[model samples]
Target: MAYQLRGGGGVAPDLNPLPPEGGEQAPPPAAEVDRISSLPEKARLRILSFLPLKAAVKLGMVSNRWSHLVNTPQWPCDSILAIHIRPATQGPCGCLVPTHIRSDQIMPLLANELGRRGRGPGHRLLRFFLKVDDAQTRPADFYSLLDYAADCDVEDFYVDAGLGPPEVSFNFQRASHRLLRLVLFGVGVNQAHRRPMSQERSINTLEVITIENTSLGDLELKWVLLLCPRLRTLVLRNCRVLTCVDVTAASERLVRLTVAECPQVDKISVSAALGLHSFRYIGDLLRSVALPPTCFGDLRICFTKATLVDPIQYHNWLDALPNLSNLVNLTICSNALKIMSALRNRENFQTQVAKLSNLQNLRELRLVLYRMNTLMLSHTYGFLRMCRCSRLRNLFLELPKARTDSFVDAVNGLAEEPAMDGFESLVKVKINNFQWQCIEIELVHFLFRKARSLQKLILVAPKGTNPERDQSGNAIFPDLNLLCLEKAPANVEVQGAQLVLWL
Candidate 1:
């Protein structure tokens, strides 16, 4: 007869029978044994920590023992608790209409959750993600939540107010040392606050910090960096108020840095970062840049404008590239190509190309194109000719949406250049947003003729465009037949052409 397991509230059967009237009870039946209940409490808690907070809460319904364990102060360790405050109603158009949610309405719920955890030395939280979609969220609520997370020894803390205005100014004077990653989006920084002597501390455990869509000044940015002594990655995007980013103080441990869309940043100085391996700057070319002399493994410089109106400033930035020699991978935008092409006839154009040739170690190159025109296409070819093609192994080209039917005529009318050596080392070429237009086919043909070592060609279709079905429910491009059968070269492997559809 099966017996009920003790403390299981009649939910699970005790597989071990009273063996032969207390004559050495047989080992518990392996198939029906409760293996999870046999593990230590710490091990079980660790397994539960991998689950989401909602799933952990639902696990309490299994049995009374589980319910008690889940309700304990140390139930969850290294778990994530995400709270999103986005109250909405259905609109007439069947869309979600965001409704106003006050901070007072959310504070009580947060308090109740935090109270249940009973924060102390025993509790630990891995990540605390809080996103407020309401514009009325007060700064005090953020502070209280941060305090609660610190009390629980949270490791990763992410706060996003991007759905609303940038009104929350965080004061990091009392930041905890247990934080390993901090991400703040659409949040400002309080510049006037100073840490008191009794609470003065540094977040030495932080390894990554990302700030986006925030209004931060240079002094405040430096102040935040100074508090994190072990930061390895720092990303600043769309921070309009930052004029300069000087990471000399935090350069010792910095390995990667990215600054994107910060239009006002005039200068970026990273004095002596021996460990920096990757650096990406995406915006207008900076007026001043001071980087380490070490060879970078990856580098990206993407200009937002098609052409900078000022010729001198444009040439000055191009002249600065030779100093960053020996990059393994490089990504540039069509704008840089356009600017460089305009100087094709000038004497310094060759000089610029020669300087760029200093990057003999470069292997991969990515070109982000905004439009497909004859001028830009010619510039792209010229830019490739400048690089050491024998060493380049990968080529990535991002194409914009096709708008005009004149592109085919433009490609046909383009002048032919003298035959040159092909890309002997190119192993892969990827084209994103591929439209099976005449110009795209012509580009593929050009690559087929030039890249002698080409092994794989990746053609990614435009978003939501299916290669399997057409608008009328007809089979379209069965097995990507267009490229493999008609366009691909005979010598090159046509089966290597891959079609990717982005849903």
Candidate 2:
């Protein structure tokens, strides 16, 4: 048949076909097996070390060689444990898996993996990270794992309990002396363990601590500060029970402190501490604050409440300004401005200007303007006149999207008003949410004419609109330079959207 089909597309005869008679065949030798498996056990473990915990666990099932390498009686790798726990999503059918099963899957897998590996005597642990979802059933096995990590003296401990009411408390009483940082979310200190542990040892090794969305009262916070003598950074966010923050002890070592959204915090007192470099607060105005005389290089104070019925009540609030003199950068929100406006109107504006004159070292000033139903032009100009920064180089003006035409006119009037000293030192100005209105154009013209030393003008238009082209597809504010070409310096540059204009 092969000879008859020679004229057509002929099939090539197999030269190495199986023998005609059934014959036994020998398997390939072991030497020709996978090269990776042939590598040294340490080299294989090194490769597995880079894989995530999930993948590393999955690797044990690959082959006998890999199984023995990773799942032996005692792992030969260095002591490093990293655990990431999150809620298991539903399967493709959209059926929710039982929380017990989800916990069973992760907890035992980790415990077993670490059981043999961490059994070695004098094992040096590196880090421990536990990020768990707010599932109702937080298994006892999970706490056991945390206890194990704590016992092992893990260096870095981070726990984020996602968006749930606090059901569990973490006892750091026996926390490792080697722990350098502790960040907790939705987890509070165990009150039962606080008294005994607070008496026994202090967390002198800790350098940073952050707590958020947890119920921590003044006593608990003060206890933490007293414990962590070397703490350099402390961040408290939306903590419900933190009514008062008095940082006299930690003030010496703390370089940065941020308290945000803690509305109940009625008072903050930080005595003379030269090491403090930055302090940021975002909530209701504190009843009182006493900052260090040395001053913070960067200070940010925001008020949660928007309205101020009586401007005269802002006297005490304005008194907080001069406490910090050497400001490299300062950010004041609408609340501060409102109070400042009240102060300006109350005392002929000179006292308010003098209060801000202490900011001789100010380099950058950022002001946020929001729904001001009764804001006056004099109030705006008064604040500007107070910023007599010899080194003032940058100014950022941010206006809310809901700003009215009257506000724009007020700003224009403020810019038109003369100052004792013009913005000679000002080199750059950034206007955020630029409306490109007639009043805004006039204000730009005024700034260009007065700020002789101004080098760049940056206009950040509102988002969702083409910066280069407006909603109608026309060039955005085509006459930006034309409006001030005569008064603007020849070297001045106007930058808006993606377009740049030069006079």
Candidate 3:
């Protein structure tokens, strides 16, 4: 959305009236001057609409011709209608609104604006946005304002009624008449709205809906899905309302669903009817998720905790991973890497392999851990040896502070078995939370030696303030202190936080 101004060639010469005494000494004819005003009213209004509301209003005050077009009901400009009213800080226009600008002052302003533009004959509203920051604002005024917006036939509505107690719920059925997309922040939906969703209502036009910081239970959510058949994308953030998300109704269009930071949800069940192509959840590890026996394009799940002592929990996770083998990109984060470390002896190597072998179709793997050490490295080696990530191109590992010697030894151990064919397909590798140490050079050296298809390697060298750079300004990493350092592979490249290099 870029806004640029193109000059109208040059301002038309202003025509001044000639004195009565002058016969032929007349200024330019009025027809030759003020070309913009001479344009049709609709054209002028369209031009004014391109300017911001503040600028358009200011221009109306200055130009009499424009004022008629702007103030009159015949104005053809489809201006973006948005209202921002807050008693504190600033008004919707970001103007310095006084602290005393109470609901009385703001409500009437909103009501009058909506009533005039929205209630006018042949009014067509393309979009509508309202944000109220004052918590003390009257509920009656707010609801009334929404009623006016509905009258305007708004297609997209975004509202953020200020934070309040759980008892304060705003009915959504009022605006569901023509809404295509609805986003609500810090507002709850009324119970009356729930029944309408279950019954056939005018909410079929809704294609996208997002709710955040609101309390809505599983039943209300099920109704939302059942009500809006055309819904394609649904997002619920930090909304702890449902213990389970069971979408067995098989919504054909609901393809993308994301539920994040919802601590209350423990189980998620989806049917083939939803045709979900992408699903993501970020919560505790103990929670269970059920997906259809079909492949999804992307599946990203984050576990809050992965304990080592719980073999039952590990077994549960093991059972879940195979069902999601159709995932193209997989991200797993937990102290569960600790479980890998705990199982790192010769006796448990095959067992560790059996657990992760379900990841057959994975192309990108992101492993986040609480710490990085020899034990974690051995577990990583076990994972790479056992899991079939043959298509894996990008590998991201988040490591904590650990000994450099152990880190290098782990890389060496993984690279020793080239027949494992784990890093053979690896192209890009990024290791975060890394400290620049002498042993890190050997780690990079071994990776560059084994991963023949490697193209780019990024390492976060936190301690090194100065790293050598090539003529192209790419960082010369693995800051080897040795006089004779191993030569990097020809096809590989190294980059630090500052530069990019191709060898």
The candidate 1 region of ten consecutive residues with least summed lDDT is 90-99
Which digits, one per residue and each the tens of the lDDT, describe model 3 over residues 1-503?
11222464234333454445756554547665556677776667667645544455677798898787655444443544666656655545544322224555766665564455556324545456667767767777777666766766666677776452234555556663656778878777667643554364547778788888878788777766766778888888878776777766435777888888888887777655347877877776546666655567677666665445563454444444435466677666645545544444436454533645666677888887665544455555556666667778888876655543443454444423324466668888877655543333444666687688988776654444344542235454545442132344555553334222334
- Per-candidate TM-scores read 0.73, 0.69, 0.64
Put down candidate 2 lDDT per residue, 135-243, tens digits, no spaces. 7536565576667777776666777665422466677676776777788888887674356543757777888889988888898887778777898989999999889
What TM-score number comes out for model 1? 0.73
Best by lDDT: 1
Query: Clashing residue pairs, candidate 3?
Result: none
lDDT tens per residue, model 1, 251-344: 8999999999998998988757778888999998778987776778888888886556854566755655535466788888888777776765
Candidate 1: RMSD over Cα atoms? 10.5
Whole-model lDDT values for every prediction: 0.70, 0.65, 0.61
The stretch of ten residues in a row with the least summed lDDT in candidate 3 is 1-10
Model 2 clash pairs are none
Q: How do these models rank on TM-score, best leading?
A: 1, 2, 3
Ranking by lDDT: 1, 2, 3
